[model samples]
Every structure is written in C-alpha cells, then in structure tokens.
Target: MSSPTRVYVSRLAGLPVYAPNGDQVGKVRDVVAMLRQGTQPPRVLGLVVEAFARRRIFVPMTRVTSVDIGHVITTGLVNVRRFEQRTTEVLVLAEMLDRTVTVVDSETTAVVFDMAMEQWRTRDWVLSKVAVREGAKRFRRRGQSHVLDWAEVSGFAQVEEGQGATHILAAFESMRPADLAAVLHDLSSKRRNEIAAALNDERLADVLEELPEDDQVEILAGLDTERAADVLEEMSPDDAADLIAELPTDTAERLLTLMEPDEAEDVRRLLTYEERTAGGLMTSEPVILPADATVADALANVRNAELSPALAAMIYVVRPPLETPTGRFIGAGHIQRLLREPPSELVSAVLDTDLDGLRPDDSLQAVAKYLATYNLVSAPVLDDEGRLIGAVTVDDVLDHLLPEDWREPDKPEEDHHAS
Candidate 1:
C-alpha cells in the first residue's frame, strides 16, 4: 500500500472513500482498532464506511491502497455486511476521543482529543500517537496541548466510566440527526447514555426519534424522569407517542405526567389509536391557519425550518380553536396554489375541498392510497366531529409500509462485490 506514514484518525472522519477506478463508494465514519496487551499500541482493524442508504460497512485496512486528507482509495472490494463491533474491537472515534488519560512523565491527567495511526510493516497499521490537552493553569483561559507516543498515555486499556463526550460531539457537530443516530447505535451502551445525557433536550429529542425503538427507550430510561419528559416534549408528538408506547405502561404514564399538559395531551390523543392507523402516524402539529389568514401568513408558516418538506407542502385551513382537534375543518390549501395567489388573499380562497379528509381510524393502506391517488405529500386526519386533528405525511406512510425491522441492520450479503 502507498499512503502517508501517519494520519490522525479524527481527520479521516467524513473523508470520502473511493474505488481504484475513481468511483466514490462511501465516506469514512470511524476507524476500528484491536487493543493489545501491555504497552503495545492497538492494531488498526478497518474503516467504518457509511455507504448508500446509510448502511455502515467495514473496509479492511488491507483493502485501502492510499490514505490522505482529501480521500481514501480502496482496492474496490469491501464487505457489505453491517459492521458489528466484536467483544475485542473498539471504535476509535466513538470510544477513544475525550478519554481522560495520564501523561507518564508529568503524571498529569489530560483528555484525548485525537490519535494518529501509522502503517507498521507491509500491510498492518497501528495506533502510534495521541494528542491530549492538560487542565488550564491558574488565570489561563486555555489548557496546554501535547502530542505523545501511545505508550506515554496510561488509560486506554481500561474501560472508561463517566467518560466525557465533548470532543466526540464537537468533531461531528455538523452531522445530521439520522447520521448521529447511526453513530450512537454503534457505541457501547454506557458510552451511548453518556453522550445522550450531554446533549440538549431538543438535539437529543431529534436524535432519539431517528434511533431504533429499543435504543430510544434505553436512552430515555437512562435519563432522570424530569429530563426524560422534557426530551419527550421536544420530540414530535407521533414519534414521542411511539417511543412512549414501547416503555412500560407505568413508566410511560409517569413521564407523560411530567410533560407539559398541552404536549402530553397531543401524545395522549395519538396513543388512543392503533399504531398503524392514520391517527398514530400523524403529527398533531402542522401548518394550520384560520380561513382569514392570508397567503403571506400561510407561506411563513410552511417556511418554518422545523417543518418537514412533506408537512410543509400543504396548509390546513380550519375554524377557530387553531390547535389539534381544532374546530370544523374547512379545507386544505396546497402550497403550490398558495404561491400563485395574491399574498393578501385569504387561504380559504384556494382550498382543495374535493377530497374529504382522512379519519383517525383509517388503515395505513387507506392512508397510503389516499396520498398516492391525489399525488399529495400530506393529508389531514379529521375526527368524528369533522375537526382537524393531525396531518400524516407520505414519509410517515412509507415508514409503516416498510418492514418492521427496516431500520435494523441487514444480514450480510451473499456475495461481496467490488465497485
């Protein structure tokens, strides 16, 4: 292999992994290593490459022909199986960064910010150096930085308890919630909980929704009841309800009680329906406006950064009591139509009343057919009294239509193919 003698593992993160023919394959998410006994540096195992469909697979270090700041060149062959960390393996980025270690010479404890690995013999690569930061001196605002041989640090071999997530979070701060969820899924339970606790309520809530049900329940259980409720409040009502449904009945009720009454009410209403029904899949919160609201108002509501594209594609026009289970549903206005109308024109003028809204009890198949037949991204779910209750998006329908274990890792492919 032809590559740099040494490269910091942190710097390799997110670097594109390409095939020998210059075709882009995946991006490096993390470096795996096998820790050896005594003071010997850990042997580099492979690169965790996140490929199409957010599938993370392992690329053995031997398959890598070159490594640089811009990209990693692989020999075009890699296992398509989901990368499952074995008992003796470790994810360098997820586990090692931010670890507190002691500098042998000074006997001072410092936090690991990054570590470098170097090619050893013909094909083997091993962790070689570590970069650490010492506590700030009195009156100093910053800590001292140091880079030493792997042998000079003393805590890598032992399992960390209460390890901080500062460096890891900072390194991947730009990752989307879904990508961050994938990273969290691959971490040890202890490490995962530690990172979850460090995240703010809104951030954690977004991440939790992207995670699998079991992981979401586990992380929520790890948090205090008050904080858990706060996090639940941040999640979308539909997602929050689904996660809460997975918990023990008593635990779920306790957390719901701790949440704000309004938020809890929305989740409670969602919980009333079967999990696969329109009511269960819909988000209680959507772009809702009174009939008198203008095109400008509708536009602004849909422009909310928090609103998903499907949810923003249509605005619900309803009577007074502008919350979920609102007063009589008037009609829905397509965003495309609203854009063509005069800004001062009332949203009611362009409403699409041809299609009656879906009922909460509507089956998942019925919901799917409704959206597909009309070519709509979202449709309103109404109550028996004709009040607008929630809006189910195409994405929600797709989620339910896919296999129940769609989010879980897939079994290894029968054949390994080169790009």
Candidate 2:
C-alpha cells in the first residue's frame, strides 16, 4: 500500500478541501506557513484555505488533510472561527501598536521601508554572506522558513546592525500580510495615518498636504461632504486656507459651515490675507501673558500650556504705560534669555524695549527678512489696534514659502494591506 503522503507549504496550491460530511468543500488557496520554535517543520502551522461558499480562510494545519501545491486539501470548517474573526474585521497596519516585528538590511535595523523609521530607529543595517551548507539548509528550509535571504537578494544591506536584530529584521520584512500588520505600528500620526488610509482605515484617513493644492482641493471635492469636511477640519490652518481658497466659493462656504466655530473662524481669518503674508500663514494660538505677571507665573503658564519657547516667541508685557499712551502693551526679548533666572523675577525687568513689529498686511518677503535679520524663530503679529492676533514661527514661515509641504521624508509609506 502507498505510504501516507507528506505535505509542504511550498508545494501546496490547488488542493481540494472537504466538509466534515465528506462533501467536496473548495479549492486550496495556498499552504499557510507559520513561524515555528526551534526544530520542527514549523509545526505544519496552517494552510492557505479556501471555500466553495465563503471567502478564503486560513484553516489551521491541524485540520489539514493534505498540503500539496495547487492542492491544500483540508477537513473541518467548524474550528476555524478564532482566526477567521480577524479576517472579517478591517486590519490596519497602523493599529499594530505593540506587536514586535523584525525588519532587515537598512540604515536602521528595522528595514528601510519608510524613511522616517530609518531616521527614528537610527540603527545600522547589517548583512553577511550566507553559507548554506547541506545540514544548515535543512533547518532553514524544514522547520523555519526564510522570507528573503540576503543570499537571494541582488542588493546590499545599506546599514549594519547586531546579529540578533539583523535576523529579526529579515523575518519581519518577509512576514505575511495578516502577520505583518499584526505588528508594524509605533510610527508617528502622519505615518500611521498614511498607513491606515492605505491599509484598512482599520477606519480611514490620509494626508492631502503632500499633493499639490489643486490636487488636495480636487480630491476633497470628490469625497462626501461630511468626509471632506473632516479632512479640511483636520488640516493645519495654513494648509486649510491654501486648500479652501482654491475651491469654488460655494464649496468653501459649505465646508466652513460644517467646521467648529473657532477653527472655522481661524481659517476664515487666515484666508482673508494673500497667501504670501504674515497674516495669511501665522497660527493664532500664541501664548500671551498679561504684563503684570511675574516671571515665575509666566514660566508656570508656559509649562502648563506646553508652549514651546521657540513657537510662542517673546512674551509681551501688556501692563499700563510702558510705551503706549493708552497704557496698552509692549513686547520683550525671547524667553530663552530670561528662563535661566528664577520665575519670581518681575516681568518689567525682562521686557525688551527694542522689539520689532509686523502689520497684518506685511508681505512674506518683508517678514522673512525681518526674522532672518533678528535670527528669530518666531515673531508676534499685531493687529492695527496693537493686539497680538497671532504669532509666526520659522517652521510656519518656511512651510508656507517653501514649494513643497515639509514633513519627515524618512517616514514610512502608507500601508496598503489592512483590508
């Protein structure tokens, strides 16, 4: 009599499946290879399951009747429920916040799939010549399956890393979609959102900023009003103004109605200026302290508000009669100079009399020169009445003037495998 057939994942393709009652079930999609502990054909972990009536399922190897390429024959539809549940829900690559994964051959030990990860991880990529001997080859082939071997690769590992981390990198780079998305998180919001929009939404999102303003407007117009409004509401004020200004007035008005009152007001105010002005690009959320407050009080507010010294710019003293006839307000030097002193120190002592000011209508070129002349990261924008309506940071200035939308280019690519 013929000996019982032995099965392997590589050889499984179109195997026939059957139900518990012996009725022919469906065709085998593939042999699902699983990562195994040391020394056993990865435990015949799973199979590339298919069904006649439902979508494909990853039937465990335990229930598999045979696994021959083109034929991953299996028995039992009853026990595949646990894992099948995941397949039903949308899987976002961004949601794998805590699943450990390995990436291989890059500037970072984590494979250089995305530029941001490479920069953030900051580890070297390591590679070695593979010497697959007869005995060694069996373990690589038998119990554990290697995804992409450097030996099989045509290019070099750009950076080097520790031996163990290197191995991990290799394993993750070649992992399956279900398993890969099981990890690959811990990236930034922009990175994660890009991955989500590409993957499953797990719920949905995207960044239209990278695209041209025209493209951003074009795409937003196509989305349902609700979703388009969400994208607009989510955008930075500068980006929002740039986009909404490009839209037809009716479209812009419709979206404005849907946005939060304050945020909508901010966008409307920003859009009022020409796209190339301090008033057009400045963020209105500058941290302003009343002039009478002590340095300590200001420091406390700074910490509590989480205002960046660089972003908030110089704190203005709004007390009575230092300069204004109305005893209105006057500005001072940057906080970095006074922060070393105790917070209890008086504000009058820290105020800088020789501060520069910009009117709302000042051109971006004028603002850029003023900031560069003073080596300033941020400058306060005062209304005609001398009220600080907003503040401009170097980043905001650069982001507006610069041709491209600037984000970390090293960030990971959008995940396309979630659903």
The digit string of per-residue lDDT tens for model 2 on 1-419 reads 01124322222334467665666656544332322233212122344343532334556544654433443345554343212322222111122111222333322112211111000122211121121111123234422323333333221212122111222223233333323322222233333333333332111222464444544555565467876777666666666778888889998999999988877888898888876788887766655666667887766655643354466556666644332211345775467866877777877677776765776788889889889988888887777777666677787677767756233222323221211
User: What value of lDDT does candidate 1 attain over all alpha carbons?
Assistant: 0.90
lDDT of each: 0.90, 0.49
Give TM per candidate: 0.93, 0.46
lDDT of 1 by residue, 1-419 (tens): 66788999888888999998999888889998999988899999888899999988889888899998789999887777777677888899999999999989878889999999999766689999999998765674567898999889898878779999988887788788999998898787999999999899999999998888889999999999999999999999999999999999999999999999999999998999999999989999988999899999999999898888999999999999999889999999999998999999988889998769899989999999999999999999999899999999998898899987787777665422222
RMSD of each: 2.4, 21.0
- Best by the TM-score measure: 1
Which numbered prediction scores highest in lDDT against the true structure? 1
- Model 1 off-target regions past 4 Å? 1-3, 120-123, 136-142, 413-419
